[model samples]
Target: MFKSRKNGVNRFAAATATHRQRIQVEHNSVLDSEYPFRLNFYNKPPAMDITIEEFELFALDRLQVLKVVEMAKIRNRSDEDYKKDIQHALDTYLPMKS
Candidate 1:
């Protein structure tokens, strides 16, 4: 059986409790009782933007390359060879936009 030590101090538990209280206060402040729309930090952005479809495509390309890198690592490849393979994958999947 695990028992809490009287002499030992739990700093993590105290910090977690403080964080949870702060999050609750922030969530309560943002809650909109009347309107469906709630204003938050994400609403504001620069004029330059990419559409969701394009973003998804970019994410998919990166994910594919990551899978390859992970597989290379799993195979116990050398660090230099892993780096080269990762760089090659990135170059092939994510070409510079011109």
Candidate 2:
């Protein structure tokens, strides 16, 4: 009975190891593909090298735009008002796209 119990533990360990390896592979694949959108959610960082200054600039720009959107939400503005505010914020911060 002792020997059978040990064998069972060993089998369970081996199964757990295999499961972990499968999960690692799946995780890597998901990270590689991520979402279809080009926008960065920081789940998978930008692949290309960027200067520190550029990174900071990008971070701050996005932050300010998001802050504006958050403020609008907190104010409990109407949908149209929120949209207008967000559009203005995006236009000011991210003018090229619009």
Candidate 3:
């Protein structure tokens, strides 16, 4: 067991912080290997395969997010509320980590 300081923090935890960060960077690299970039301006087709159900679900979710933005614009919402609504729609429908 690692010796703990008065604050109950372990020295080993601090010592391994860099190791954890390195592991996280490697994990992110692996995850991004699938479709790293947000856009494909060159018209490149996606290489990954998805089930039919997954494809439909993704399509519907994207449509919902677009509709939310459309409705927000039609309603002429305030700037703050507009951003909040858009964020809510994206988080609820088509969330992707940056």
Q: What is the C-alpha lDDT of each candidate?
A: 0.79, 0.80, 0.82
Error (Å) of candidate 1 at residue 20 is 11
Off by over 4 Å in 2: 1-15, 18-50
Residues 1-98 of candidate 2 have per-residue lDDT tens digits of 35345445577788878778432323344545766444658766578998999989888989999999999999999999999999998888777762
Off by over 4 Å in 3: 1-48
TM-score on alpha carbons, each prediction: 0.50, 0.51, 0.50
Task: Show the lowest summed lDDT stretch of 10 residues, model 1.
Answer: 21-30
The stretch of ten residues in a row with the least summed lDDT in candidate 3 is 22-31
Candidate 3 lDDT over residue span 1-98, tens digit each: 98657887677988888577432334445335545664545445567989999999999999999999999999999999999999999999987977
Residue clash pairs of candidate 1: none
Q: Please give the lDDT score at residue 52 for candidate 2.
A: 98
Q: How accurate locally is residue 19 in candidate 1, as Cα lDDT from 0 to 100?
A: 81
- The residue-by-residue lDDT of candidate 1 on 1-98, one tens digit each, is 99979879688987887788433435553354443256645544456889999999999999989898999999998989999988889888987756
The lDDT of model 1 is 0.79
